[model samples]
Target: MNEAISLEAVSKVYGKGRGAVAALREVSVGLPEGGFTAIMGPSGSGKSTFLHCAAGLDRPSSGRVRLGGTDLAELSETKLTELRRERAGFVFQAFNLVSSLTVAQNITLPLRLAGKRADARRLAAIVERVGLTERTGHRPGQLSGGQQQRVAIARALIADPEVIFADEPTGALDTMTAREVLGLLRETVDALGQTIVMVTHDPVAASYADAVLFLADGRVVDTMTGPTAAGVADRMIRLGAWAK
Candidate 1:
């Protein structure tokens, strides 16, 4: 399979000399196209830093990160911004929706920002796919957490990006709602052949992924395929993520 994202000897450091902190150390991984992968680790384990580098949201201090065939390190800031806007999509724990805009408007915000018109047929399909057709006319404040997330998902899908990077996407929802949202994410990978890389702390949430990359001490320590919630929790325990 083609790689949607690849990192080679990527490292990130926050400061200089004695005051420096290393977030990622010689991290290298390739996320396969059309695959769903979850990144998990103890707090302070560099999960967020890894995601930012892989998605071109931040530059690695050394080594290379490639989105498809484009080398992120080679891009100018303006070029990187354009690449991110055109090729990548993001979903955050916080549903970063405009408060006053209706769901449809919010979903089409990216297109608007890019000075491109939203294709009506494609917008309708994305909204229906996310099961938010009925809520498109409503503002974010009027929707439940799950519905708001669905809108976020719809917005991510609108651009048909090569990959979607989601950070703790279901962290704000209740169990049942989180399940629904996760199921929707799974369906997108299965049905639409979407590539998703998500960072989640919850084992149940990680179970939705095809594989889990476990990070500890700024490096990938292990990987588990066909992960289950119990199995993932056990692995975390072994990693000392739950140590008292």
Candidate 2:
């Protein structure tokens, strides 16, 4: 398993001196290429912060984060932005599509910004894969919540990024919709060999990943493999996350 993401003794602190607040502390983890991983933690447990640092969306104050063998900490802001565009993809609970843009436009916007053209054939194939082929011309406001999320997923895949980072990808959906979206994410990893690192609090969501990392108080506290919703719940329970 070649490493796609590597973090070494990473620490992130907000503010300075006596007013400083430690957000992450000496955290480290390795994500195998072409693998799917889920991160779980209670609120303010550093799950989102860790994901941001690992994906180069945020920098750790004192540590190293590498994506696809390139040191993210060493890159300049422009270079870091380029690296993210070239090698990393991002998804969030909220569908951040432009209300006026059609599904096709939303999907190809990144390509247009990168000054690269989106191949018509490739765009059509991806649209079909996301079950949005028939809705390509519809604006985001005209789509269902589930369909909006599908568009987001398609947009993330359009760049053929080395890794996709999702923060609460299922947080805003209903149970059925969440399950459907989770299935799609898992399908992409299993069928497309997409490397995904998802930050989720739900055990059901964690079950979709090949592995799960549990964080607490800004540190990785445990990990589990062959993940099942039950197994993930037990780990969270042990961490007092599932209890009052």
**RMSD in order of candidates:** 1.2, 1.4
Local lDDT at 53 for model 2: 94
Model 1 lDDT vs. the true structure? 0.94
Top lDDT prediction, candidate number = 1
lDDT of each: 0.94, 0.91
What TM-score would every model get versus the actual structure?
0.98, 0.97
lDDT of 2 by residue, 45-112 (tens): 89999999999988999989998879987899999988888788888999899998899999988888
Runs of candidate 2 exceeding 4 Å displacement: 241-244
Compared to the true structure, candidate 1 yields what TM-score?
0.98
In TM-score terms, candidate 2 sits at 0.97
Off by over 4 Å in 1: 241-244
lDDT of 2 at 130: 86
